[model samples]
Target: MTTISALTVPDERVLHRHELLALGYTPRRITAAVRDGSLVRVRRDRYVRPGTDRAVAAAVRIGGHLTCVSALAVLDPEIFVFAHDHVHVHADRQASRLRGPGVSHKHWRKSEAGDVRLSRRRLTEPPASRHLLAVGDIVGQLVRCLPEREVIATLDSLLHRRIVDEPFLREVFRALPARYRRIAERLDARAESGTESLLRLLLVELGIPFEVQVRIAGVGRVDFVIGGFLIIECDSKAHHEGWEKQRSDRRRDMKAAARGYCTLRILAEDMFHHPEAVREALLGLMAGHPRA
Candidate 1:
């Protein structure tokens, strides 16, 4: 009779410590398996089954989990892009020093809130108690957990607080989904990109028919276009660097302008910190050039 313990996927995570002991596999046995290339140690107490997805196998072997961006991607690759780094797992700080190569662990303190807690895929139980979450639940967990604005805020705060170095923050940011290209323009409003997101949102709210990220003829791409008549550009200082950038931007604007495209550039400060100004400017721009 094949028991649950006996059932093997070769790649499934080794769950509990007792499971390892139950197999009656001694260190000599493990060493022999390693020598034979049949077993690979993922962490100190973790061994991966050959031919399985390394991250999933690593997660299972460690009896922890793959969470954050990696989990998001595995759960919904379409929505959440994969981060090409260590599989992030919530683990004890002490156990990590003893972990094998390539397995990155993040310490979970009680101070952390809804952020890390959002992406936990419940450990699979026996068949009788299984209740899998829906696709919507997965997506919702990822989106609400991210909240682009919050990422920006965290970045800004990190600098302000001088708590950690930029390198660390960069790694953390790199582990996040860059942008939702599918709903980028519409959801921009939901993001902290302020001008870009808000302008897109307001235009949608105003029933403006516009194409996002449309490339212009003999000119660079515009942020969004209204009925092929007007071009909208959302400029945040975070994206623009210096005078050379200003000159390059002007050149692009000139090209669009020469093509009889009325261009409007909305700044980030104006869009978010002062939204009324954005509304007024957008309203004036729309009024002058009615969408045809």
Candidate 2:
């Protein structure tokens, strides 16, 4: 039996029986703490103080660490947009099959010649089970795991919030295959939201020349300015759905019109669900205003 002391465990509040024993705690004392409600068993060997993050608890329950978008969300919930309902977990390729409610398991396969050097790189840090993949590793996994549009949106969010710089993202891109490099090239740090980033990507795919976060004399700052005279507003519900915001938007549109700019406001639904309609409307707008 190993000697244990209260001073040996750091303040993280999670502990394993082995750790407690090494710190001079007896098995009897460990049982008493659990019985008295001072420690909660997360699993067979893992114990944590009450009120740990449920997602972290879930990751521990699945016997893996959070990675990809799930890790990004945990690292910075303010900026990273992890829209999926399932909690993402990362485990070794040879690990046993994972089964649980609301868990998305990602197996780390051996890295190929062109794949990111996931195995060789020190992208993971650990206390064994509760480890988290580094931000750069998460970004690399994101590109490989998510759709291209989603990758752009996530990267744009990361860039816009200055959570990660362009150089760091370029490094992440370099870890990818040649075909995936275009995503890095198209990234813009000025995008204010995922919707704006998605809209910008759509416009680029349409071969439209645009400027982001353009300011007009009367209108505050428009999302995107195309051909120097057309204002495109990608309206996210959280920001633009309120009556006060709608009124402010109308005022801005009128101000833009006075300054010889035509405003096209595209809601989240229009841009996401009816993208072709958005394309047609943009084409129509461009054709009607040749100067724009």
Candidate 3:
């Protein structure tokens, strides 16, 4: 007579074995559900509702504890998920395997023990002060972690004070994909903006020649210039707010028009969420101006 919907989780995405026990599901029932494809095992003691998201399920099934970027994103859904290696429970000595793929363990001393949480069976993030970071945050942090010669020194000053631990920094470098390793080497942490970084990468992929942070005749300095006829501006909403930015952008557009250069404004949302649309728009715009 116990309906699964009768149960509730502290975090909708995370679930613990004891929570299921409290719900009257015995080990036999749990195993039966798995056999019947009615439940998915996340970790040794964890079972998530069948067909749950892979990341959530994995977090539950491999529940020694997770921290760093994966934990941060899982705990704070506002942050986007990008990195692959999930930081997991670690002791000074190697422990028995927790039960899942894609899990990375770090040997934490007792001082780092209480950092992991088991709320509803899902992994959670450590405090920001504890040197945890997300993918976006890591991109900025790497500028300082790598030697000055490895990346531009300008980036060091930008990220030197920013929080990223030595371990997570090493993980990112080791995990860097072959395709992105070269780009990683060229990253400058003090570059002033993620929008600028993403835009530059896109432009490079698009084969558009341009200058960054250069002043136009009337529009002052834009993010990029293409053929001196197009001005590209990258805006991050977190940095821009209210009617004031809108008005300033409008005036800048007018000035660019007066100087005979076309203006294209790219927002962070457009870049991350609607990349295809942005790409199509850029393609259409460039159709009129073939590459020379």
Candidate 4:
């Protein structure tokens, strides 16, 4: 079986030295493994799998847990729709030596309660890994750092993926500040993508009449069907990229058209990079298209 060992750690790729040593790998053998490219060194005492994610490695190298949306991205990249690229780290408040590339945000927990012993925030720091932070902690951090819509989008992803359930969400919400707790009500697991969740948030805020992932007899399941007649699809580049997918989508739109449904596909970039333009276009479309 393949094994990994590293003397130090800066990433998830690093394997534990103890695991190898316990497996009867002598120091000489470890060195031989390194020399033969069977093991790669991330730092002194840390050996890891060769093909681990770069951001994950960077966070571990920085002596911190990868966390927040950065952790979410590693865990389920498809669920990511918010515009955050930098690796986020959760580190010690007193760590003096924190230096690395790719880590733009670092988080250290603090207690707001007067007595530190009675603090609500977790004091425990789990083993640093490619994806660190508990689901509740991740949600809490998202509430603190991201905007309302973005947080809801992530929450929707967690819910849709069954990474979290209603009870878990309630517990998480109960711990949050009152103002933020209410946003939890807007989460809908029917959102299949971060972009879909984002669009749902817009529709919710605008009080638009719409249903998510509605299936029409002729057109199959759609991202959103608005006012019973308008079909809105939040197309991420991954979904609508090639000519094959585009051709398939056109066929679906053609099918929807036969049933008197108007389809409006929005590029995910437009939603992320040009929100106002997308909102205006949707508003114009809704105005012209009569409601069912």
Candidate 5:
């Protein structure tokens, strides 16, 4: 078996067979490297280093580019959102259907033919030769495809990361159908995670007036200050998993309570799974407190 280190080519983890041939690697040497487990065959023509990202490999296997929330999550895993349940790929409208347990194919539409071309022509940041969609196109597809609450969370994440500015996002919103335009208008960059964004959107729909990221005199900064004296804290396992964080959060809550603020801690699961329970609890609190 040939040594992979001996073959000098582009440094990218994922490489096309044609690229290797052009870089002076003979077919025999490439085959030997694959046999020796130095390279992994992701698809018929695509190869990647061992343990490459499954999502990218799936997209390449499907003969398309990653788009929508799948691309965004790959770009920034730190931003809290729902777990990416599948690999999302954008392919030609007439492309053959793809089959897999966790693969979702998004077919290009006739009306989006021009937009598709534009997305392909424009080079995305980091220059993803692995066939990831452009940021703009990804955002456009996300606004059109994802639910309203999810769209708000995604836009907030993009804005927080400065991936797309307000003006550019406004253009994306305008390009969407009229029904989705209002949803974009409700986006708040202050939302630190998808769960927080969803909670805020639900509160708005419930006609509850609340302040976000409010800094109380004793409490540093609360998630959502509702009805003036009610503080709603949204927590996730990522942020509040450890004992230290739990202790800190309890201290904050106690300090707020001492100052007449009723603090309610809402977990990520509560916000996503049992939203009705959350809504009913919020309504009860609002009714008792009455915004002062």
Candidate 6:
């Protein structure tokens, strides 16, 4: 019973002091918990679980909630690449002496109970965590803070995860500038990963005719099929490990080659970190093939 209840606090990440009190934690119990290293005092009225993300607790301590890429990073890790290596916060305009680690950007809003932000990003009530911004608001921040491709990647992940559909995205974009509405059209939930989303945009920019998740006989679905016969597989480093998996992939490639398909394997890391090289390689590899 204790273990099960423990999970709720950790999962919720941060809670107000009154909420902790309502949960039957007296001042002494709360203090003891803090001393025992189970509860962290984020601020006078905010308490975070020991396992809570540092950024979340820091934001709360700074009289703000996590926002922009930082909040999304916590809400959905591995969905979108980091826009910056720092945390972004949404704090009260009246709050002062604001300083925290890794908090590069702090968005200010009028202080209100249960009303996190409205001045900028026009945040709805925080869906799950008070310490976190709403998804639509986070996307709004991403659109304002990051470049086009990065923002689209965030939108793609949001769709792929079914956190928000196309219509909801359209509605949110409609409230933003005219150019943002156009970005919603480029999002496709079929993208299985951020790297895939980025690569799709790259292909579109390069005017490459390719299909995603194409399945061939004797082999399972591949990431992309280009030039009609070339199979491009995007994989992360994890896929390269393990001999059994490697053998299975080799066998699949052999089967694909037997069926007159040329297989080209690309790592997700290359697509993310060395995009120019990947682009050059793709351009050179398809130099002989007619654009389909």
TM-score leader: 6
Of the candidates numbered 2 and 5, which has the greater TM-score value?
Answer: 5
lDDT of 1 by residue, 178-289 (tens): 6532232223222233345556556766677778778888997777888778887888786776999989888988888898888788886776667677778767777776
- What tens digits encode model 5's per-residue C-alpha lDDT throughout 14-120? 68999989989899988998899988776666787778677766666555667777776666665444655656667545446432312334443435332222123
For candidate 4, what is the lDDT? 0.69
> Model 6, stretches more than 4 Å misplaced?
1-11, 93-128, 290-292
lDDT of 3 at 10: 18
How well is each residue in 1-292 modelled by candidate 3, as lDDT tens digits?
0101111111454456788888898988878887998776655565667666455544434433333344434444433333334333221123444443333343323344342322221112222221122333333333323332323322222233343333444444555445445534555443455456666666777887878778777568777778877888878777666899889988998999888778888887777567777778777888877542
Runs off by more than 4 Å, candidate 1: 1-140, 144-198, 268-276, 290-292
Clashes of 2: 5
On TM-score, who's better, 1 or 5?
5
lDDT of each: 0.50, 0.69, 0.51, 0.69, 0.70, 0.72
Residue by residue across 1-292, what tens digits does model 2's lDDT show?
A: 1112222122343577899899897989888887998876656677767776666666665555666677667666666473676565665555564334223343323331121222222343332235455566667677877888888888888887777788777777777788899989878888888778888888888898998888788678888999988889988788787899999889889999998888888887777678899999988888888695
Better of 5 and 6 by lDDT: 6
Candidate 1 TM-score to native? 0.43
Task: Output the lDDT of residue 16, model 4.
Answer: 77
Candidate number that wins on TM-score, 3 or 6: 6
Candidate 4 lands at a TM-score of 0.78
RMSD of 6: 6.5
Ranking by TM-score: 6, 5, 4, 2, 3, 1
Error of 4 at 249 (Å): 2.4
Which of 1 and 6 is the better model by lDDT? 6
Give the TM-score of each candidate: 0.43, 0.76, 0.47, 0.78, 0.80, 0.83
Greater TM-score among 3 and 4 belongs to: 4
Between candidates 3 and 5, which one is better according to TM-score? Answer: 5
lDDT winner between candidates 1 and 2: 2
